[model samples]
Target: MRKKLFRATVLMVVPFFASLLIRLLYVTNKKVFHAPKSVGSEPIIFACWHGELLMLPYLYFQYRKTPNAKVLISSHFDGLLISKTIEYFGLETIAGSTNRNAAKVLIQGIRALKDGYDIGITPDGPKGPRHEVADGIVIMAKKTKAKIALFNVKPTKFWQLNSWDKFIIPKPFGTLHYYSTSEIDVSEMDIEEAKLLIKEGLLKHEA
Candidate 1:
């Protein structure tokens, strides 16, 4: 009985806390990425670091303003939580990984590109040696010939929770720095160079 009640309570409260956090963040920072006028109408593959996942929903929703945009997610429990939360924000998820069902997800991403919806990915996400970008985003961009946006976000203040990824949970009413750099040139990359380039970018950011 105790276990049953505990599970029930957690299910109820976890979502509440998630929603509360999202609302608080939405009200916090208003300045993030502004879609460029020329790039406004094209499909893009947006990449960001893993730690900033908590605040991504707020950013996504603000840009969407309507029902659009899709993200690639992993088939894991944490992905379950993020997928649910993303859906709650009216975004869609295509479940896959660099190792599992990757082709399917890439195809889905291509379809999204053709449909005029952009694909967003955490270059160091799902699981990570925190902030280490992976080659997956570049591979996807190369396949789809989609422009890449290196999404970046920083919080003025936040607690870095003790998780494998050191997830950042931004404080209520905090400031956030968000922007994206120009398209990552991935056309010449094979798997080897892609991996090296990804690590280089990660090191650049960490530096």
Candidate 2:
């Protein structure tokens, strides 16, 4: 019982500090935004590789200061940490993954879109065979008739973890070069076609 209480306490406290640390790193780093023309006022889908997830919440906030956005996250422990961390940046979270709670993701994702909330998803996330586009993203876009935006950030100096996604941590004081694609409409494409487009768009700038 004591151990469980300590573990619960750790979960609640870590995300708060983690978010602060992320902000610290970002504020010290040089940021270059190479954004395209705005996708206008309509809610749109945002997709990126899972490896690029760390700095994206901050980027999203820079793009849409009056944010009405929610990120799709897994229902597992790490996802809880990520969900709470991004919440510090005023982003809500939808608890689901491509592998677990998938139906919940589809339902909540479409609902969020129809209600004018932008949704962010890491296509091959929460257990990735890295850099692959999952079907859930395609399904959600089709259901809501929303456009998808592909995003990527390249850091001048960073540490790459050996994790499945080879997660990146931009070293403080280095430059972060950001890029985003124009809104992509997958509403008319069949599932396989849409997934291919998404995967290609995301990997276009990959090293």
Candidate 3:
């Protein structure tokens, strides 16, 4: 009973506060996008590092705004909060992790793609070795014949958490830059090559 109540309260309160914070910070902050509008329009797989997830949902809402998008999330306690938060912004969640139920999640992602729902994934997530690229994302793209778009969010001023990903929280008013690479065609490349390409695209602007 206690666990259920706690979960219910978190679901209700977290989304409201998360959405409010995202909107407030976004409006007050200046934003820069590296790619053109067309890149944002494509329904390809959106890939980013786990550390940069703090402002990603808001960034997607601001730029992509795909109502049918579904994000890959782990089936952990933290994932529960994040799933609820992103759902508030109209993005669905697939609860599973790379280390567990990976095949199931990949299948779900493929199906979502086939159904024309945009897919978002953090390749190095749900307990990460930092920004290392996992092959699951590449394989999903290969199976679905969907292109991959690598992105990174950098804030001029922010707080970095002590977590594995070193999660970031942008200061109330700061410059946020969203960088993305051109859609990567995975048809020709094998999984390993695709992984390398995505890693490069995501880390290209990192100093």
Candidate number of the best lDDT: 2
Clashes of each: 0, 0, 0
lDDT of 1 by residue, 1-207 (tens): 997787566655675667677777768755555443234446777777777777666545544567578888887755766776667677788887654676787678788877888888877667776666666777777777777766556777778889887788777666776555556667677866765665565445442
- Among all windows of 10 consecutive residues in model 2, the one with the lowest summed lDDT is 57-66
The lDDT values for all models are 0.68, 0.88, 0.84
Model 2 per-residue lDDT tens digits across residues 1-207: 997798688789999999988888898899998888587678999999989899997667656978789899988888888988888888999998877888878899999999999999999998988987889999999999999989998889899999999999889999988888888999999999999999998888878
For TM-score, the strongest prediction is 2
Candidate 3 at 179: error in angstroms?
A: 0.8
RMSD, each candidate, Å?
Answer: 3.4, 1.2, 1.6
- Candidate 1 TM-score, C-alpha based: 0.79
Candidate 3 C-alpha lDDT tens digits along 1-207 = 999999899888987898888778888899987764555454688889999987787556545655778899989989988998887778899999766899898889999999888899999988888889887898888887888877789999889999999998888778999877777888779878878888888889887
Q: Give all TM-scores, in the order shown.
A: 0.79, 0.96, 0.94
Model 1 Cα shift for residue 36 (angstroms): 5.3
Off by over 4 Å in 2: none
